[model samples]
Target: MTVESRRLDGNAAAGRLADVFAFDATVARTRCGGCGTTAPLGAHHVYADAPGMVVRCLVCEAVVLRIVRTPGHTWLDMSGTAALDIPDGDPS
Candidate 1:
């Protein structure tokens, strides 16, 4: 399928991510290992129709994050992310 038809903006994954992260994970910035493009996690591409969620880089289309949930566990893999900056929720 075409990438456009297979993906949505990362905001769609926020609810699922909230179960794992205490903060709003979508606001976090991530650097792509494949292209070095840095942007907010919510700005990336997300595919949620699969068995799990697949987050891809905005520039290189590389897999930046993956999360799979089973009856007893949640698996998270971020091997394609070079860096991640999560906001501390500070007003500053």
Candidate 2:
């Protein structure tokens, strides 16, 4: 299938995204394993149309993360992420 048919911005993964993170994961920073580029997770490509959510790096188009859910388990694969930086709460 073509890239457009299954790809979307990270926001599209929000449907089940809450199940993975308690905070707004979109603002989180992640370093792409393939290209070593660091960017907010929201800037990546999310293919939610697939069986699970596939988050790819914007610079290298490499799979950064994958989240799949089953009846009683939620699976997450971050093999493509070299580093994940989830900041602390509001500094306000």
lDDT of 2: 0.86
Clashing pairs in 1: none
Candidate 2 C-alpha lDDT tens digits along 1-92? 89776678877766566787997788789999999999988889998867888999988899999999999999999999999898897989
Q: Choose the strongest candidate by TM-score.
A: 1
Q: List the residue pairs that clash in candidate 2.
A: none
Residue 74 C-alpha lDDT in model 1: 93
Instruction: Kindly give the stretch of ten consecutive residues in candidate 1 with the minimal lDDT sum.
Output: 1-10
Query: Which candidate leads the pack in lDDT?
Result: 1
How much is 60 displaced in model 2, in angstroms? 0.9
Instruction: List candidate 2 segments past 4 Å from native.
Output: none
Candidates' C-alpha lDDT: 0.91, 0.86
What is candidate 1's lDDT per residue for 28-49, written digit by digit as tens? 9999999999999999999998
Residue 19 lDDT in candidate 1: 85
